[model samples]
Target: MATPNELTAMRRAIAISAQGLGTTSPNPPVGCVILDRDGVPVGEGYHLRKGDHHAEVNALTAAGERAEGGTAVVTLEPCNHHGRTPPCRQALIDAKVSRVLMAVMDPTSRGEGGAVVLEQAGIEIERGVLEQEALLVLGPWLHSLSTGRPHITWAYGVDTDEGHSNQALTELRRRHDLVIRRDGTIEEGVPGGHGADSFRVPLPALGDEPGKALHVLTESGARTVLIEGRSNEAARLLADAVDRVIIDVPGTRPSFSLTGPGAESAVPGGFCLSDVKPSGYRVRLTAERVTQDQ
Candidate 1:
């Protein structure tokens, strides 16, 4: 069981992890909070990008001598293998932390598990502290790793502020690492952020389909995309790519698939309107693909 303070730290860690979303592609957005010997939060940090110190290192660096004999509460298990940076497990061991608390286990961990290494180093280990909350940020990257394609969401009429009133809009922006518009406009995910300049390569021509646009995003190591455009144009961008659909107003609109009529699909599973509710002056509809297990 996790203490109340630890649980709170885990939530804070999860929130910090979200800050790394768009920039930390090819790497999971991870966050860490360092608690001093008395369980007082001394420092907190998040992974900003690859080739940068991980969340643990950043937090540990901030914690300094206070980290010794303290606890490290991390959203994900610390990495045990050496990458661009040295192994994080070793960092924890070197910090001499008394205990390590984590939410999810790293499926990509190499060699001996970080937990095993930590335990061998005389540090206590706690797992699954707010795992589901941590998954909210990790899911997209893991989805891309498993499927070899980015998870796509098509949002209609929710791009502009005065257009729709729904909480999903905020959630969409927070989770999506990439944003695409059929009109060749780029959404920076954040207003006044880097926008299209974040992409490493030139974007495809306006006439090209979303597939070509996706290739450029894939190169940026983005694992999830949020799409915005008009009906048929947004539909054209969706076609075989979309994994989720968000409609601001209920209507009898045609499916976005390139195929005609009953053969409609955004992806293999096809999307089904999963939820509907009122939002301000309009009804919001959420459609998601039915996975194999579902």
Candidate 2:
């Protein structure tokens, strides 16, 4: 249960967490808000990239002495074990934050999550505040962890006209962590607006089993990837690796993937089409990978 002021701060934390979307791969995007004893927000911060300060540390630093006896609201669990930086739980303890609230626990956390460590330090703890909202950004990272590979999406549309831009494809690229294409071309986003900057992500060729793509994604910390290519080029990329198929149909073409160069190379499980909607001059067809149970 959260009070009105705390809920408002949680919403702010969620919004700031999305700022780390493309850059915080290998590490989940996290946001934090520090509230003084009077329940007024004193400071806030979001994790910008890996090897940078965790959200709690940044917010605590911003709040300074105001953080003592205050409340800390985080979009994700504060980390307990340290890798590149010091554990965030320890930072909160050092700040003497009286209470901590988190949307969800880190699935990768070992043993008892960070909540236990905080409780042991005599700090009050609560979980699952605005959880579903947090999952909107955290899902891909969790999916990547569960699937053992990057949550890959194949984005393509038929545009006979050379100059036409695919709105759906652009939206997908903007939402994804990395944009990759045939011939191993890769792009990643930088510290700028959403439109500019991209990661030069790489993937193995079609038959390169147990290839470098997964290792790079996991070891390097990218959680999602978008592959933009034509039908034939899609065939050349790994068919089974894709988790979702995003088809873009221009005003001229009625649909896609039905009669294309890569039609023969379709994955064994095929795809389940959903959400047929229009975006500018194109109709977007979002398809989920049909698993055996479906």
Choose the strongest candidate by lDDT. Answer: 1
lDDT by residue (1-294, candidate 1, tens digit) is: 788988898999999998988667677889999999998999899997777889999999999999999999999889999888898999999999999999989988988799889999999999988998898888777878777777777777543323444465666676666666556565545443222333342245434566666676676566777776445364575567677777665334455543443313222345677677776656666788777687
C-alpha-based local distance difference test score of model 2: 0.75
- TM-scores, all candidates, are 0.77, 0.78
Model 2 stretches astray by more than 4 angstroms:
158-171, 189-220, 232-236, 250-278, 290-294
**lDDT, residue 156, model 2:** 64
Over 1-294, each residue of candidate 2 has an lDDT whose tens digit, in order, gives 788888899889989988887777777889999999999999999987777888898999999999999999999999988777899999999999999999978987755778899999999988999999988788778889888778887766655322125544555666677766544556663423222122334454433543554566544446887777654354344567788876656544556454554422322347877567676776667778887888
Candidate 1 Cα outliers beyond 4 Å, as residue runs: 158-175, 185-202, 205-216, 232-238, 250-287
Give the best candidate by TM-score.
Answer: 2
**Every candidate's lDDT:** 0.76, 0.75
